[model samples]
Target: MSRSTCVPTSEPALVVAVDGPSGSGKSSVSRAVARRFGLRYLDTGAMYRALTWWCLEQGVDLTDPAAVVDAMDAMPLEMGTDPAAPSVRVGSVDVGQAIRQTRVSEQVSAVATNLQVRARMRDLQRRLIHEASEGIVAEGRDITTVVAPDADVRVLLTATELTRLQRRALELHGHAEESAVAATRDQVVRRDRDDSTVSQFVTAADGVRTIDSSSMTFEQVVDALTELVGSRTGRVPRAGSA
Candidate 1:
């Protein structure tokens, strides 16, 4: 198969931006790509999850957009940008595990959909992307179009609906049975519908390369992105095939 090339750049730092729907393998692919390129990794979803955790802890109503935005405005969130050791700490609580709970999964969209919250997140994300001294791999719903459109490499990683549902079921339930998939439908499908309202990830933006990973293994996806990057950087080093 022919490979796509990233735009050539001399900017001191190379930013690789990837956007995709949930369960499309973008997170795993982006992390693997970051490991390969030795770039800092940023998981933008974790930020919203942490905020959701915060709102629930503070007893803020999810229906009140103004309250949500105010809490997020003062939210003391420290997001670790290293993909190798990605961490999320809300105040004194290390919520890396807490934020991934089903509770946060169900309610995060309420906070993420707040236009003010998104604006604040966009500012923070841009600053984080710029601060990655040795380049970074940032992935989320809007990184390619909204957050880092000028990234050295912008990719839209995607997978089919059935494939995405099955993958998410496996991740959440350790099995991809019908029961598991049914349980995961709302988390993956409903959230995607709600997130699409504020950010576009279901389709690639103009000039953004789209990698459909429906039939690709995790390693294959990583390798494809690496090749895409290498094409621009010229004879780039592989990220170690361990």
Candidate 2:
């Protein structure tokens, strides 16, 4: 796509794009940054996961790009941000719980790989960014590269493979069988490979800041990101307000 194809926004609204593999702490850090700045918090991965859940509910063929494309046009997705309680809706039904299932997690990558699916999803993401007033903290694999290439601050958060796997295991706790954690880890790695390979998505460049979360606490990550935002914008973000 040409650079001119990207939508331009009026005024510098401090768009922050956070990209990382699953369990790398992108979601937690993005939420913290949004809370600190009072910016709109958008979890783009949840959008894809919601679509995955919807497709499964509708019995769409996961491998068929055409069917996935058709379903994409028909699904209605709504996201709510409470910071304290975030949720996602598909149609009029709340599917926040469904989106996090192992089934959806296993299928989301296959569904997300369809070019038509990505295009449709990207359009929705652009609308979310456009509609935001103060600013937005958008987190996803392609946010810094495709969705918001010109974001004021782009962060690529990463952690050691073992650390990520441990974190995922903790999150799953009683939700997933203990024996399935390794399989889930493999799935996440495979999905990351597929997304980066097929989509040609790059998270960070020479100037983009990369944060290693392997040795950092959640609070430390937030503090570093807040400082980065301040350094870039020339103003410290007002904790709990933008």
Candidate 3:
């Protein structure tokens, strides 16, 4: 894998780009990794969800491409940088919880697939990465390939479909039973299909390391990335730093 890759810039804001499928535990693991190393955290997926929530709030039709792009052009999204308490707000309403609702998950793809919308969000994500003085861990579907390909350390976390489905089921339903997995499959499988049309996240791009989290526990996943960062950057956070 390409874990030893490093950004050549002298800037102190280390941008760690992490891209992965939805059920691959990108958000939670990214947050933990950022906290461990004392870096800002950005959930790029939440930005898309926030836009979807805004479209829904304003009764914008997702099928209308022009309308969706216009809806996101001026959307006021405030993403919290704290790893311990990551938050997403639109205007003054905290839609952090609302964005994760099943409703948003189902319709978010419509907004995410619009080329114009993605371009705008991509610019915002790049600006966020640039503005983080203490560095930032940015995780989403396209961070490695599109958002910040020049990131200091780029990682592509992946897992088998069954493993991803089960993990997502457990996260959504608190159990990974047959019924729960069935219910959660579309969230992973379908959204991935929809997202792939616009971004190449199913496989690792050149120079991006891939970590298979199928058999790994959550702690193990975090440790692997932490060690990878250490291998590349020459420093790893001590245990219990988070």
Candidate 4:
């Protein structure tokens, strides 16, 4: 993992919102940015995935929007904000890892696309952001536009389809070979298509910065975002420190 040598500056009230499609590196980059800036972190997609996991565990009909919304209302979710060890828990079960399984990934879009569910989640997300008094780096599909449109720093991190596909493949599988990319297409491409119906993450919203990471290394992307934050908040990192 690449890391910046610049020491982190304390910015307790700086909220950074990052939005992107699947495999765009929003989660990793946002978490790293949060760590770099001493901010809390929230992965909004994991919230939807946890809901999907709960519905599946409870045998609720994901096809029924009302049931999904009801599930959302009764969900006892605990989201950890620490970027170093973020967790997702539903009730007493620790599902931080289970939510990332293929099962949840396949059904998450169905739960996420529900208009009622999104409305409820928007409220819950706002509350969570408010509670993170020290600041937060919230990343999700609609975060930059819907969830936190007025965050201190809003970013839309994107990359070419091929780049996204390859990255996701490497993360899911162990490599980015053609076979792995082929196996990972549905998870990366189809999910983005379904989720895009409710959020505008493909393009940068007004006053939102867009970081194209197609040719940039992970550290480079993080460095760019760090620099952007510095430019916006006047906490610039030392030149050539990384």
Each model's lDDT comes to 0.90, 0.81, 0.92, 0.91
Better of 1 and 2 by lDDT: 1
Model 1, range 10-70, lDDT digits (tens) per residue?
5488799999998998888888888777788999999999999999999999899999999
RMSD of each: 6.9, 6.7, 6.3, 7.7
Superposition TM-score, candidate 2 onto the true structure: 0.88
**Which pairs of residues have clashing backbones in candidate 1?**
36-239
Instruction: Tell me each candidate's TM-score.
Output: 0.93, 0.88, 0.93, 0.92
Runs in model 1 with CA error above 4 Å? Answer: 1-11, 238-241
Error of 2 at 31 (Å): 0.4
> Would you give me the overall lDDT of model 4?
0.91
Q: Tell me the tens digit of each residue's lDDT in model 3 across 1-242.
A: 66787769754777899999988988889999999988999999999999999999999999999999888876888999999998999999999899999999999999999998999899999999999998999999999988999998999999999999998899889999999999998888999999999998889999999999999999999999999988988766856795
**Residue pairs in collision within model 2:** none
Distance from true location, Cα of 115 in model 1, Å: 0.5
lDDT of 4 by residue, 185-215 (tens): 9998999999889889998989999999999
Clashing pairs in 4: 12-134
TM-score comparison, 1 vs 2, better candidate = 1
